[model samples]
Every structure is written in C-alpha cells, then in structure tokens.
Target: MKLSKNFTNPLAANNPVIVQILGICSALAVTVKLEPALVMGLSVTFVTAFSNLIMSLLRNGLPSRIRIIVQLVVIATLVIVVDQFLRAYMYDVSKQLSVYVGLIITNCIVMGRVEAFALGNKPWDSFVDGVANGIGYALILVIVAFFRELFGSGTLFGFDVLARFGYTNNALMLFPPMALIIIGCIIWVHRSINKDLQEK
Candidate 1:
C-alpha cells in the first residue's frame, strides 16, 4: 500500500505539475511541439528515477552538512547524462529543448523530490515516487503539447492532422503563454474533479 501510494499519488492528487505546480517552466517551453515535449518528459523521468534511487541508497552515509551539495551533484550528473544522450541521438529535439535540458538540475520537481522523499525512504520506494512524479509532470506536458501542436501547427508530431478538414492553425497557440493557459485550464478542471484539491 505504501509503495502503491508513492507510485500513484503524483499522478493526480500530488501531481508535481498541476497540483504542486512544480516544473512549469519546461512544461511551457517544450510543449510547443509534441516530439520535443515527449523527449523532455522522458528525459526528466529518467533523471528523477535514477537520482532518487541513488540518493536514497546514499542517504545513510551522506552527511547532513553537505546533503544539499551532494544532491546537486547527483542531480547535475544525471541531467548531464540525459543532455548528452539527447544531443547524440535526438539532436534536433535537443536543439529545440536548448538549455531547458541543462536546467533540469535546478528544476524544483527534481530537487524537491530528492529532499522531500528520497532522503529518508528506501531506495525502491524513492524510485517509485520519482517515477510517479516525473510521469505526472510528463503527462501534463504531453497534453499541453498535443493541443499546442495540433492547433497551432495543424500537426501532430509534424504530421498534418487537421489540414484535410480545412482547419486553420491558430498562431497564438504556439506561444508559451498559451501553454500556461492550457495548464491553468487543466488545473481548474483537475480541482473540480478532485474536490479534495479545492479550497474550502
């Protein structure tokens, strides 16, 4: 049950993106297109999962005085690996992602999970929490990117999906602000559905 909660809560009730409002920058920056958004999401998921597992494994031996520094080092190393991997195989998407890939080291979602959950939890549990939160964040990115790319460019993953229907692409949907609006709508709807998230 404990492991289940760790894996499930972040998907909704404790979502890192919509609920906790963490990692919104990348959500907006990379969601202009579906491909980049998917790549970014998977990258974050990999980093989060491994970072949590590593930190959890080292928690007992890590000195409190240097915990934050150590966490940064671990997170940065993971981010670098992801960045390099993207540059190697997904060069175009990596170029699209730009510095946002490097910025994952400072992402509140990654650091927050490490500090909040990984520090004291067992390795497996922390890994699950990280994967859940990363997926939660990724899910929002995909949804936002789907709408943005589909309507803004009339394409999904660079394929013309709506052109045959005489659908004109909306230029405004390509902007970062549009992603914000979409995320806001998502949050509002999410809160409405999950009444527990609504303010009493």
Candidate 2:
C-alpha cells in the first residue's frame, strides 16, 4: 500500500540519520533520555508529514525561482504549529526540548524532504516521502536513545523497569559525549554487519 512506503522506507536505505546524516545534531543533543528522544521523533514526524502534504499541493503554483523560499515558509509554519502544540500539552517535555524544538525549523531532514521530494512530486507521494524519512530519522534516534537512556539513567521512559538489578548508573551516559560514543558504536556494528557499507 502507498501508506506503507510512507512509513517504512525511512527505516533503512534512505535513513535520514545514518544515510543522509540530516538530523544528527539534535539526535546527539536531546537523546540523553528515551522520553525526550521519543518526543522529538514524534514532533519531526508530524512536521515532515504535513509539510510534505502542503508543499505537494502548492508545488504546482510555486515559482521556480522562489521555490526554496516557499518551502522554507511551509516548513517554518508547520514547525511553529508543532512547537506551540507541544508547549500547550507537554510543558515539561517542551522545556527539556527547549531550543531544539524551534531548531526543528533548521533540521535538514524536513527541509531536504520538502525540496528534494515534495516540491517535485504529487501530494500523496510527497507525504509518503516525508513520513518515510521521519521514520528513518526517528529509528536511529530511538536506538541511540535506548542505549543512552538505559545505561545513563538505568531506565527507559524514566520507569524503574530495571530496578531489580544492581545496575550502577553511569552518570557519564547522561551527557552528550556518551551519546556520541553510543552512535559511533552502533555505526561500527552496522558497518561490520553490512560489509558493503564499510570501506573496501
């Protein structure tokens, strides 16, 4: 189904995090916990999906010379809507997310999707592309968050899921450096398994 492509394609092959590295900056910043990471992922998905949809509908009317400007406007407008919604509903998460939510306006993943696919494709196809890439970006962030949060905080979603064990929480995992290391380790494992992705 068309919707399947929109949701699944970004998980691999066209992954925004590993393949394109479009949104790694935020991935490193807010992924210190699974909760914030999940919030960021969901926010990006919403922004990308709607931006793609609207841009596709307007693509036909956009002037070639000012297409980039139009895309920026659409993406910024949707991001603000998303930001305001988050602030109203999840003030804590919004505070934790802070500048990153606003920074979503500059996230290469959203802008890239709008320009590369939405600007040139049908509305439906563009919507699918946005969802797909958002999934891809979220997938990596989730993995990174899972490891960082687990070892860093000794829990997921801040739940005492592993309280039974004598896990000594490594406070270092709570920092950005820990996230960088976790991501590097994941990329190493990924490259090892997919030999073709490694240097010959």
Best by TM-score: 1
Off by over 4 Å in 1: none
- Candidate 2 per-residue lDDT, tens place, 1-200, comes to 86676566577655778766678799999998888899999999889999999989998878999988888888889889988998999999999999999999899999888888887788888888887788777778889999888887789898865555978888888888887787778777766776777766
Q: How do the residues 96-139 of candidate 1 rate in per-residue lDDT, one tens digit apiece?
A: 99999999988999999999999989999999999998999899
- Each candidate: what lDDT? 0.94, 0.85
Pairs clashing in candidate 1? none
For all predicted structures, in order, the TM-scores are 0.98, 0.92
lDDT of 2: 0.85
RMSD of each: 0.7, 1.8
Regions more than 4 Å wrong, model 2 = 1-7
